[model samples]
Target: MNKPWSESWFDAYAPERFEAFTPSHVWAVLGLIVCALLLWLTRGVIRSHKSVSEGIRWFLMAVLFLSEVTLNIWYVTQRIWDAQTSLPLELCSVTLLLSILMLFFRSRWLYPIILFAGIGGALQAVLTPNLAYAFPHYRFIHFFVAHSGIILAALYMTWIEGLKPTWKSVGGAMLFLNGLALIVWIVDTALGANYMFLAGKPSTPSILDVLGAYPAYILAEEVIALLFFSLMMLLFEVLPGGRLYARSGTYKKTY
Candidate 1:
């Protein structure tokens, strides 16, 4: 006997566990690639048409917002809403919120951080999701959708809105991330939570697996963040006629 579609979708304690690099993972990655390709293909239309761009922006905002809301609803309904773990305090969750604000207000200050940290963090989450639920589960869908929305939001701002980040923006993003991490660390201490993996690394294998132990891995992340943000700048800025665009006022400040 098989579960009805509705039962499986809403089952909070989904028995299926996500395995990394499985066929399901490959399909999920393919889906994200298709989404990115579609966005790239429509860059011109989105850029030229304000109505279409704003519609996409609002739609993304709603999707990201609902992703978070419905997850919390499921947690509460299932009686598993632990403050220690259920709160939206993880790095990707924070990035999801920033992505929503970035789309909603089109904040230039928020753009650089989202472009670098938002995309970087969300991409990592998509690649090696630290999630429990497998495909077709609501949490599975919510996890991928929320993370994908973060990456899409940043890319839309960059490709469609022509928001270009400078070298200074790399450092700014690092500062913003570290500051937020510090705050999360404090909250983790107060609540005995492991938000952001600040108190410890994830139980599952992750990029941190190779970074070293505990506090040392935390230090390694600081160095990696700087390098990662710089590389992001190089790809988005330097490789894309950055100097010429700057001189030509094509990369004009939004604010």
Candidate 2:
């Protein structure tokens, strides 16, 4: 009664309906913690080795770009490539694109937006993933790689490259996110797609569940996002040498 690997891989639309915060979830959380620790530990090496650092950045960018393309291809192969759902309109999807751009071009204007969105959006996605798939599934792998890549990129820029965010940068990120949300709302209305969950909350339990009902929850999310952004800023203040690194102008030319 053994199923083919592909059958097992794509089967059940998710993993046996596992509950949240299960063993797999615990492992996923541990993985993120390990990643953060590794990144912090390697910050010195990344800063000291310029060419190597750039190579690592480029490699991460390529991984992100290719992972996204592969996801689209998988959807097509599965015959599930719906225009409404497959488009890169989700906040994390948009974050991936911006993360790539930030890596390639090192745009100063995008620093805070990527920082805020990457941690705010991608970190949350990793923690409370909307994914149904579990380990060894392509969907599960792709979901983690894509979201984790955003966080890594943001950290690389801040810790290694020394791009710092100001209070004004926080405002900029809020404005950019809300403005993009407005456009997505229009698109969601037109196509009846729930990109960004603007149409409604997801069927699965999520942070949205505790936020409140539909439209009201959307507003609450905005407030929550702002709070998260402020907290990320505070993180820099508390980290050892973070403020000094931010004040340093060594990498200003790149930005």
Worst 10 residues of 1 by lDDT: 246-255
Name the lDDT value of residue 79 in candidate 1. Answer: 92
Question: Clashes in each model (backbone N, CA, C under 3 Å)?
Answer: 0, 0
Give the alpha carbon lDDT tens digit for every residue of 1-255 in model 2. Answer: 657777867654544543467787778778877887897798888788889889988988998999899998888877888879999999989989999999998877777888997678888887788977767677877887888888888888877777778666788899999999999999999998999999899877789989999899999999999999998877866777656644663235322
lDDT of model number 2 = 0.82
List CA RMSD, all candidates. 2.3, 2.7
Q: List the residue pairs that clash in candidate 2.
A: none
Off by over 4 Å in 1: 1-5, 245-255
Candidate 2 structure, TM-score to reference: 0.90
User: Could you tell me which residue pairs clash in candidate 1?
Assistant: none
